[model samples]
Target: TKKALIIGSGIAGIAAAIRLAVKGFDVEVFEGNSYPGGKLSEIQLGEYRFDAGPSLFTLPEQVDAVFQLAGKEPKEYFAYDKLDVTCQYFWEDGTSLKAYADLNRFAKEVQSKLGEAELSIHEALRQSAFIYNSLAPLFMNRSLHRFDTWTNPLALKSYLRMGKLGIFSTMNEANQKQFTHPKLIQLFNRYATYNGSNPYETPATLNIIPHLEFNIGAFFPKKGMHDITQSLFKLSEELGVNYHFGQKVERVLVEAGVAKGIRAKGEDHYADLVVNNMDMVNAYKTILKDQRQPKLLLKQAKSSSALIFYWGVKRDFPELDLHNIFFSDNYPLEFEHIFKRGTIYEDPTIYLNITSTHKNDDAPAGCMNWFTMINVPNNQGQDWDQMIAEAKRNIIHKLNRILKTDVESLIEVEEILDPRTIESKTSSAQGALYGNSSNNKFAAFLRHANYSSSIKNLYFCGGSVHPGGGIPLCLLSAKIMTEMVEG
Candidate 1:
């Protein structure tokens, strides 16, 4: 059997290992951390348990497909419940909206609360579905670098309808034209942050995001978001994929322009093929330093990072759900601070995820685990210590004002994850949650291809590479990358 070596035990890496093992390869995964899941790991704060990263779960069928590919039932290993209310959105102006999972109910809610026309909400979602259905085949499910992808009948059909797919306008522009209410526009525009892009600048093609939540449905793992990684990790091991935890890879051993294997922990392990699930930028700079670099792709602006405060609140708020958003008073100005100014805004939009809403034991009785986060610029030699301090003050003040309580007093436990810590822990380039910003239309095409063009038996998967970021895309990245492999 051919031997396959994978670097990193991230969700994508684990998925790739399972696929390779099922293909009859001897797969081994090397992880720098002692644990699996990378950012999808969990943290214990006193009596509270919080999912460390990637709280939102969507496109669960992708995860199911992994188990199905391995001839196992996904439900036997993992389970999730579709949320009736996807998210609760709150604005500083005393306005609130519950984003119901049912599209018709949600549209009616928008009409009732925001005073927006129900037809407008329906039309916006219709556009989102159109974009997703049209482009997902060519851009998402297949490798864009391959000529066959562009020449496929479905791809050709999608290209013909590109203009109508919202490629030319920005996400904000598309939302502005679709809805009359500014709050409605803001709610829709927030989808850009799903991939860590600025809605005001990212191509309107990203409007396809809303369809995933409101249309298909939002889901939470029965155990918590960390269960996503734990379940997959279990599946991979059951498939005979070996894991070497805390063994950091030092270099990708290349000879005469072909990847042979990897060197880690002062030892060399050879494999028939090497798959990289690490951040594309960091991987190139460190392990593949001597190899030819895709400088242009590496230089493209990075997606936004986050400053997360894992707060173990002493009490629960019924108004909040598994997912909640607190809108900034000045949305555009906040983006300017994050993307252009490279600073956190005083009034930044906040995302508060409370897993205890569904998984009661995640917190103590009458308590909640608040995974509070704000989008901030990627690391660029900024004073994060000071920034974190100031940002916390701002966040507490905003939460107190909106929730009508002293949020600062409710915290019984607290932990912070900033860009610096994210970079150190996950090895994401500059702590970017996603690989690259889709601020420009060409970003999808510009993402690193699944397979190395120059090096034989080398492949890339995960958020930093083709397709894009988030758990679903990262899993899709693995599927796309591994399809090129031949046993």
Candidate 2:
């Protein structure tokens, strides 16, 4: 039997294991933590449960695809409900909007709430849909490098139409031109953070994210977002994928420009293929020490990390939905604080997610679980404790002002995740949520290829590699990597 060694048990690693095992390979995963699901995890605080990462689930079809590949019905292993109310927004300027899953209702809501042009909304979505249909086959479903980029006609069309992908202009620039309302613009601009990029700096191509959420629709798993990992783990286990918990891969064993296997916990395990689902940057600096490393890939601009606080509230608010956004007074200024100054903004745009709205069992009866997050710079030797202290005070004040409630007294439990801890735990470079920032126009192409062109039998799949981060993309990255292996 062919042996495939996976370096980490992150979501992508677990997905890759399932793919390879289903394809007739013997798979073994080595994880540093006792648990699987790197970011797609949960934390238990007192009597409350919260999804540690990816609070709002979107594009669940990508998740179901994995079960189908394993020759199983998705409903048998996994299932999710489509959200009717996608998200609720509250701005410091006293603008509130309810985002519905239905386009007509949403447009009518936007018109009544923000007085935005209804016609413009249709045109922008039509444009966004065109972009999604055009690029999904080329950029998302397949790897950019290899023989396909040269010979495949679809890839060639993607290459020719590259300029129109809207990478050159910023998202703010696109929406401002597409619509008349600044509030609508601000609402749409927030999509840049879906991949952990700043709206003011990231390419307008990121506008595609809104289409994915507002048009294609968002969802919530029956259990919680973390159930995505749990269901996939259950599937991987059923497929006979072996897992080693509390095991860390110390190094990638390279012999004469080819990957031999991985060195983990003072022992060398033999394998024909070494699939590294760890962060791409760390894969080079730590594991590929003996090989010639690409200086450009190492120096690629990284995406912004986040400072998140998981608060178990003692009460629930009726206004909040599964997803809520409390906008800062100056949205652009917040991005400046992260990208330009490399510092956390005092009044950052706060994202508040209450999964208990849908899954009330996540918390005690009459209470809520809040996953509050704000974009911050990647780890660069900042004083996180001090920054976190100031941010908490500011966030509570901001939320109280917008939500018109006493926010502080409701917090019954708290857990914080900063860049320093995220880096040390997940091995992501500086704890960047996505591998590289889409700050630059070419960032999509700049991510490390799914398979190494310079090294043989070495591959990558995870948030820190090509096709990008977040739950759906990470799963897609694994699918792309396994396809490369099979071919």
Candidate 3:
């Protein structure tokens, strides 16, 4: 059997390992960390348990497909429930809205709360669906650099309808055109942040993000988000994929322009093929140092990073659910602070995720594990200690004002994950959650392809590669890379 070597144990890498093992290859996964799930790991702070990264779960079919591919029952290994209320949105001006999974209910809620017409909400959602349906197959399912992708009849039809995708205008511009109220427009524009892009500059084609959550519905693993990593790792092990923890790969051994294997800890491991699950920029700079670097691709603007405060609160608020968003009064100015100014906004849009709302063991009785996050620029040698201190003050003030509670007094324990820590932990270049920001129209084509254009028998997967970031796209990158490898 052919031997396959994988560089990381993230969801994408684990998925790829399982796929290759099923294909009759001897698969081995090398993970630098002691545990699996690069950013998708878990952390226990005092009595509270929090998913260290990626709190939200969507497009579960992608995960199910992996088990199905391995001839195993998905439910037997992993399970989740569709969320009825996707998120509760709050504004500083005493306004609130519940985004329901049912479009009709969501439309009525928007009409009642924001005073926007129901028909307008329905139409906006329809447009989002249209964009998703038209472009997902072309942009996401297949490699964009491949000629066969562009020549397909479906691709031609999608291309002909590109004008309707709002690719020419910014997401803010498109939202302003569609909604009369500022609050409604802000709600739609927030979707750009799903991939860490600025709505003010990113093309409105990204508006399709709303359809994934509100239309298909957001979900939560039955155990918690970390369970996703645990279950997938379990499945991979069951499929005979060997995992090497705490073994950091030092380099990708290339000879005469072909990838032969990898070198780690003063030793070499040979394989028929190598799949890199590390960040594309780091892979080139650190591992594949001998190979000619794609300077232009590496130089592309990086996506925003996150500053997360994991708090174990002494009490729980009934008004809060699995997911909640506290909007900044000025959305454009907030993005300006992140993308342009490279700092954190004082009144940043606050996201609080409490898995304890569903999983009782995540926190003790009457307590909640708060995964509080705010978007900030990627690490660029700023005074992060000072920034983190200032951000904490502002975040507490905003939460107190909105929730009518002294948030600081309720916290019994706290731990922080900043850009610097994220970079050190996951090896993501500059700790960018998403590899590259889609601030410009051409960003989609600029992402690193699944397979090396020059090197033979080498492939790439994960957030930094083709199809983009987030859980679903990361899984798709694995699928795309595996297909390229098999072919």
Worst 10 residues of 2 by lDDT: 146-155
Distance from true location, Cα of 358 in model 1, Å: 0.1
Name the better of 2 and 3 by TM-score. Answer: 3
In the predicted model 2, the residue pairs found to clash are none
**C-alpha local distance difference test of each model:** 0.93, 0.87, 0.93
The top-ranked prediction according to lDDT is: 1
TM-score per candidate, chains pooled:
0.99, 0.98, 0.99
lDDT tens digits by residue: candidate 1, 1-487: 9999999999999999998998999999999999999989999999999999998899999999999999999999999999999999998889999898988898889999978899998888889999999998888999999889978899889978978998889999988899999988888888999999999999899999999998898899999989888999999898889999999999999998889999999999999999999999999998888899999999999999999999999997988999999999889999999999999999989999999999999999999999999999999999999999999999999999999999988988899999999999989999999989999999998899999998999999999999999999999999998899998
Model 3 lDDT tens row, 433-462: 999999999999999999998889999999
Evaluated at residue 259, the lDDT of candidate 2 is 87
Model 1 accuracy (lDDT, Cα): 0.93
What order do candidates take by lDDT, descending?
Answer: 1, 3, 2
- Model 1 regions lying over 4 Å from their true place: none
Residues 122-176, candidate 2: write the lDDT tens digits. 8888878877877888778888786765568887776787787786788889989
